[model samples]
Target: MTTGKEYVTAVFEKVKAQNSHEAEFLQAVEEVFDSLIPVFDKYPEYIEENILERLVEPERVLSFRVPWVDDRGQVQVNRGYRVQFSSAIGPYKGGLRFHPSVNQSIIKFLGFEQIFKNSLTGLPIGGGKGGSNFDPKGKSDNEVMRFTQSFMTELQKYIGPDIDVPAGDIGVGGREIGYLFGQYKRLNGYKNGVLTGKGLTYGGSLARTEATGYGAVYFAEQMLKARGEGFAGKTAVVSGSGNVAIYATEKLHALGAKVIAVSDSSGYVYDKEGINLETLKQLKEVERARIVKYTEHHPNAVFTPAGGDSIWTIKADLAFPCATQNELNAADAKALVANGVIAVTEGANMPSTLEAIEIFLEAGVSFGPAKAANAGGVAVSALEMAQNSQRTPWTFEEVDSKLYQIMKAIYTNSAAAAKEFGEEGNLVLGANIAGFLKVAQAMSAQGVV
Candidate 1:
């Protein structure tokens, strides 16, 4: 009898051999594959159909060049990528990231993760991600506009609301999405649903900005309730001062938790008296300044440079790693556990390392994986699409209520799947198996497209 670990190792070895240079993609694959071993034991038909091999490969990969002129009249060039990883369930749906670090590996990894994340949403959407290597920081509004127009000039041919819908992620936000949508409309003409995360004046859905962050807190609340605990009086340390972290902190406060810390790429801010939400929003969303500037406004707060994994050392009852990929590792996990942290929820995609996840599971800490916890953003994106299709809009309260129900459903489904698979309460396994089974069954029914 082949042990689960041995089977997982075999599948992972094949993935590594094929994608030696795609480290990020391989990591995502390994994580999902590792969790599917128990399911494979129960359903040999999945192996017989070679679903692992099929799911690992993408349905399509598109790459193009983007050329635009800066304020200095100098022509600049960047690479753009769109990986439509899976459409087994519905049209391709994901966000478009714009950062200097954007690469094929990162895009593929994000797209691959989207498959399961979309599945967990219980919505009729598939997995896809698109982005470019163009860094939008420090660029004037016109410069950014010209670049987005150029990027959309090439991208407009491949995307539509029913085909692939792109939203905001990381460096891409309302400003960037606005530029992209404007250009797309100019070229394609009046397609409101083709892009998500739009301004409220347009087809953008309410509660979209707060979806991922709010959904994470809602999931955390459910996790706590499972253990006879709640967010009241708990201290939280949330890394990253971006939309996810900021709104997550806001929701935490509303739920009776004090978020003491939040970070950015440059460093993190620790406020012993609790983080001021308005101050954080001004720095991050309005001024667009570095997180270190937070201390200048709140004299009582202390700003510390971000050494590798230093944010994990902060003691708190709950930790939300809303930073980038692999930000939390085994060492960080150890520190969190040592600090008596009870729950760790991810607001960013794949923010926790596999080793760190192992540490949390071993210590019996409630860990909310990124796919399930962060699906709120994409879930609401789907809602925006529905509104566009119907030519109607939903109120903030209505959208938020629906988001809450979706998050609750995700937690319940994941928990039920985990219990069914003998890893009771292991969200990692629960999410992977539940999401995998959905996509796998869809793929099998579709006849291996």
Candidate 2:
């Protein structure tokens, strides 16, 4: 039998030999594998067929041109991608991001990460991710609508309820999902569950909007509970003003944490009054304004346009990075440590760079990796799939409570895996091993594809 180190080394060799992968994507995959060595030791068939080699790469990657017309009669074309990474346990499940950075490399990394994250959720959802390099930031509603419709027209061919179901991520939100779903329904007719994060008027479940953030907090709560602590008196600083950040702030407040700061791409607003959650929801969810504008409404809050770095400097017991990848780096991690931050939880995919994560781990903070912490969104998406399968909608409270339980269980399992591997408190190791074992077992039972 191949040793675990030999298996992991062979997997990395295969990864390095691949001609189609980008450096960032390869590095991300390598990081996950680096933490999954213990799991391979525990389950050796993963070494025989080299399951790691097969699973490290995506099963299929769909790239298409999304051409749309702007209101100015100008033609705009964007690159769209859907990477169905794995489907060992069930159908493909992930999110669709819409941003300038949505390239094959980034989407592949996210899809690869999703494979494990979905597995960790203990839900029968596989891993896939789709998105476009179309920036919806400065676009008009009509332009966005046209773009969404055009994108979905082609994407619908490759996705479905039982094939691949996608939800919102990053630049994509309710409006974008509405537009995509409208186009999808128009083409494929009214079959629910093809996409999650749908509008409630259609078939979206309750607590879906708040799942990622609330789930992160819920996972954090579990982590704290394991250590005889909780969020009751913690001060938190969260980054981003989008769906995840807003709801993360809301949940932190609900748990009695004073969420003192939240940011967007432009700037961050720090309020000593513990971040007015209602005011923030009105600004981002309703008004769709810049986060700096927050200080205009509340003169007491300090608005810093210095980006995520400013938020990292705030004194807090918890720091939740809910923005895009690499938003927090080594410098920011140092600043957070200087501020006496006790925990760093990722609400976005790889929000912290390698150096930042190393810093957090070395500091002995209760760090919750994105896969385990952010699995709430996909877990709830799986619940949405259940509702769709049964043709029945669960009440908001029911779904919310279910989400809470799943998050707790994920934390427990991930934490247990970490301890069993002799890497207690290292959730990065725990989550990767726990998630990998699930997918690997399913793949083993299904035989070689």
Candidate 3:
């Protein structure tokens, strides 16, 4: 007999009571639940069936110990985790992150986000994520290989092409994917569909590397066009020097936006004359050097040691938060809005805190939530799975074109859902509602387990 808001509050309270220590997971769940108030009101059957209760809980959670040998002939141990949040729509698909910060909370948060992000792509993908507390930083190639090999030795047992597919996330890249795929192949034979983000020599999809960054830019362009604005002749700032930030900058520059800054964990490189993509690729991608090294190559560019959300202080027409979760906060959002940022595109999962999102919306910024704006990576990941299943590979341009179309469709769907739900232009709510309705319907059709 509870009202819609009351039901949402009750479900969220139950989640929090059960997972009091999981801050990241709680935040993600709360955000989605907040957006479902309208949906719950419209479809009271969802409440009667306890869909929120079941949806909030992960279907499967696997935890294991990953022990590997370092180059020094010493044994190291790390915790590995995988959570299959849902499989209502299709196979559980997500990424494996390798970082010291990888924990149950982070993985659960990511897996939970992946459910909506994947559903928003209009792809038959569910939600799953796996990772380890294994930090790849400063590790030798052999060390990384040994760790990934050991990690996959166990992980391969649970995943298959038609079941759960894990790609790469933070601290996981082509090198790690190559190592993990090799181990999976060594154990289970040549299954290209077991993972995405593989090297070109293998079954990796073309443009998979650039899909996330490029997709964010593509989604941002749609947002701007809707507002009768565009990216031409505008200043922008992108955080992180990783794959997402780099390619997002590339796409932004291609759309006639001058991206003046890009950062790494150590610091941010600000180039008033515009960031040199070639130099950046060489330093971060090729050499794997620090952002400070950019200053060494281009003396004109300034390298500030202030990393994280500090990049928001730089005035620009657009803001691309391609960094880590909660990197941008209320103060950072205030700074970006005060500086007249036109759009804020998320290229990273949950990069902006809840308060930061509110600030952007209140200031009339064209905000692209991560679930809608960043679905490109997984959309192409599904495409890669399709190619792998058919034993055919797509050309770079072909994949890029498809990625653009998918991003456009995601934008349209999210905007329409928001408008229909009486929160026009509120993409956060729109994305959550649109994605949830799809999975909820699927789950309902399948009946309760």
lDDT, candidate 1, 1-449, per-residue tens? 55555666787888899889998998999899988988878877777677888888888999999999999999999999999989899999999999998999999999999999999999999999999999989999899999999999999898998999999999889999999999999998999999999999989999999999999999999999999999899999999988899999999999999999999988888999999999999988999999988888898998888664488899999999998999999999999999999999999999999999999999999999999999999999999999999999999999999999999999999999999989999999999888899999998898867
Top-lDDT candidate index: 3
Off by over 4 Å in 3: 307-309
Candidate 2 lDDT: 0.89
Q: How much lDDT does each candidate structure score?
A: 0.93, 0.89, 0.94
Which candidate gets the maximum TM-score versus the true structure? 3
Cα lDDT, model 1, residue 248:
98
By summed lDDT, which 10 consecutive residues of candidate 1 come out lowest? 1-10
Which residue pairs come into collision in candidate 2?
Answer: none
lDDT of 3 by residue, 288-391 (tens): 99899998889999888964448899999999999899999999999999899989999999999999999998989999999999888999999999999999
lDDT of 2 by residue, 267-343 (tens): 88999988988889999989889888888889999988863346898889999999988888999999998888888
